[model samples]
Target: PASTQRHVKSINKRASGQAFEVILKPLSPVSDAAHSLPSPPKRDISLDDIQKKLEAAEERRRSQEAQVLRALAEKREHERDVLMKAMEENSNFSKMAEEKLQLKMDQIKENRDAHLAAMIERLPNFHGPSTSLHPTPSFSPALTLSRADTRPWRPRGGGPHRHITPPHTIMLTTAISIISGYKHG
Candidate 1:
């Protein structure tokens, strides 16, 4: 019985020593490790530092804006150059067209003048009664033969005769007669 009691006491003391060792080992390592690690670096942030950073950011933004404005100005200048070039081309085309029109008008005027000169050259002068005539006095012409003569005469030549009967004149006379008859009716 004495030997049994001694064995139990020895077992209890071994268990207590193991528990104490487990607790003390973990605590000492944790505390020592915490103390050995360096503390985090101190940061003394000031309002001046924040203001300087903000100013730097603002300067960068301003520079970007300036670059954008310069690019826009260059683009506008290029566009203006293109527009001016197009305007110049249009003006040149217009000038060419005007010149062509003027040339055509000049050619038309020259042709008309030449035709008039030819017509004048072919026509006979009628200042006096010595010109050719048919000598027939019974035609009862509508226009006077001359300013001095009371007899009327018909044109004899074929070149644009002044006394030629117009087709419209017959139509006009018929229309007038019909209108007069309708009015009487």
Candidate 2:
């Protein structure tokens, strides 16, 4: 029986335009190889990968938006805090000013009260024993004169007596009468 020989051929080409060839011999089939061979798997794709990427991007976007919103909130909160602080300070200042004014008013009232108290203390007591000051004049009905003596009294009806001498002439006549009486005495 002739020997069965397997020949391999190969070819190569060089940079100088040479050519090269290679030949491979097929191997003999093994029993049960089909069972040992692995089949080509279908290309696999998992929804988890795309979903994870989407989730990561969404998370990043959410984080960025949250940061922006947080910054805005913080700014508003800071402004509110500043406004509150200013209002509190203003209220405190006003309260202090009011207290100072009230204190001044209280001081003025106290001074006025003290002055009034001193004045009251200085006033003489009316209910105490009377001291000798001036002698009171005794009153007599005979000392009272009517218009007849001071001036010539005219009667109610426009009738007999109507003496209307000027005050100066009456005073002169009374002085002359007093001088003549003193000379005669």
Q: In candidate 1, what are the lDDT values of residues 32-107, reduced to their tens digit?
A: 7877878899999999999999999999999999999999999999999999999999999999999999999999
| Full-model lDDT for every candidate | 0.56, 0.60
Candidate 1 to truth, TM: 0.47
Q: Which digits, one per residue and each the tens of the lDDT, describe model 2 over residues 37-112?
A: 7979987779998899999999999999999999999999999999999999999999999999999999997986
The RMSD (Cα, Å) of candidate 2 is 25.0
| Poorly placed runs, candidate 2 (over 4 Å) | 1-53, 126-185
